[model samples]
Target: MRYVVGITMDKRGRDAVSLALTLAQSTLTSHPVELDLVHVIRGVPPEQAVSKPEREFQKLCLEEAQQWMAKTHDLIPKTIHSTTSVHFSDSMATGLIDKATERPCDLIVVGAASHGPLRRFTVGSVANALLHSSPVSVALAPSGYLPPSRLTRLTCALGMRPGAEVALNVATQSSVLHDVPLRLISLIAFDARSGAAETTDAASDHAKKLLVRASQSVDNATEVMVDVAHGRSIESAIDTLTWDEGEIVLIGSNRLARRQSIFLGTTANKMLRSLPVPMVVVPRFPAPESTADDDISI
Candidate 1:
């Protein structure tokens, strides 16, 4: 499956490119895989489609994106199919979804806007829109995150009691495309990193068993590992592992109610805020079946 990661000059997005590069390298380890990194600049709003400044800004955004791409020419691979385009749609999120569909990408990764605790729930109006609307799976990168690893070592937070098989499936599928191994990390018991080291060690042990169970259930074809980690927060335990320059933290989103608002999961949010590594947030489940032109047949 082709991996499509959406990136931009936005703080979090810029770092996500590093994360995307890590995933790209992993997938291409044996040979080569199709990797497309896209940047979508918002067009004029429908009501003001004719605004002169809007058009000018659009042009500037595209030009800047191209310039940035040129500067990073050395770091990015020549084998990977990389391209940039200007989308003339008023809605940024819509433009992104439209692009993903055109490319028929199997996975989509993007970043959450930089908003404070009070406003994070409503980040990137366009990004949030796509989350609830896109057809294929969508992943969100944490804000200002930079990975210390070159591979995608997933520390999935799925529980084993019930209603968590879906997460297991997500992790396994990711292992296939990422070509990076996945470790089924379950947060057994965590208080704070301030807690005793013994407590954290025990939690990591519990997660290992869950990973073993996951290993047995999924296709044992790929190189996957399972471990249980603990932290003052789930994020800290993940940090305990050694992350290379291109590593990433893939996470799942938490449900936000009507009045509760939309936001990244607790552990994910914390990780994003503190870590420099790139991370991806996989939604709880797949997008609805009915989609508009998600994959054009012809």
Candidate 2:
């Protein structure tokens, strides 16, 4: 698998690169993996030449980007493979998307916006834009976060929707590839009409059934578990669950304007707003030709 990591001359950007390396090493142990470290100079046109002052500014930006890229490269272990490149564009988000598409990377990894008590897990403008526009999967690493020692668990936020099955399949594959356990979670917000207890029961029942089918789709050696969280709001439901340091969440992307673009649904968006750990937003896979007979909803 190939991963494109967005780099800037900052600590947060370096954190993203570190997380990307961790993922590549953990998930692609048997297969060859590549990481492309990319830095984009925003507000600069790729085709146009700049004046003397602007040229000097561009030179400084490139020099800074190169230094950061070099420092990041030194941190990577000798076993892992990586390359660095710089790009010029009017928008950083669009430039990242274009670069990833050109490489045809499987995933795009980026850092959180900035470091602050309130913005620790908050997505930055560039990352938020990529989440909506990128064609490939996008992974967000929290600010000041170091890669976990091991990726032992994959927690998937399962939904009863058309694209959810795709997310499950991706999660299952990741679990099998990394030799980890998979947890299929469904968060049900309390509805005034449905009642809390009833909603929780129904969601739990559906989740168990979905887990059974999802497990059968993956390797028999892969272990799958299911859980249902209920609360007044999505954030509350997610907060109720306990998370491991090595666990990562996978949620299906919901696209509206583009057929296969990466867009978060209401619930997914809320979860990202106060994300507890690193999260990967999996793009909806194309529908299969034949439908199988199964009772699972997600």
Best by lDDT: 2
lDDT of all predictions: 0.55, 0.76
TM-score of 2: 0.90
Off by over 4 Å in 1: 10-14, 28-32, 45-48, 51-75, 111-135, 138-149, 161-163, 176-179, 188-209, 217-224, 231-246, 255-263, 274-276, 287-298
Can you write out model 2's per-residue Cα lDDT over 130-237, one digit (the tens) per residue? 888777788888777777788878899987666677788778877877778899999888767767787677777879888888789775867899988888888888
lDDT tens per residue, model 1, 1-298: 4555665665655544655555566664553545566666666533454777766766677678777655544456786766555555657667767776785455566666766232122246656675556555555555554544556455456544443444566666666655566666555445544556775565566666667766764567566675555556655765665654444545555554122112355554555554544445544554333223322100
- Residue-level error in angstroms, candidate 1, position 97: 2.5
Best candidate according to TM-score = 2
lDDT (Cα) of model 2:
0.76
Steric clash pairs (candidate 2): none
| Candidate 1 C-alpha error for residue 189, in Å | 5.4
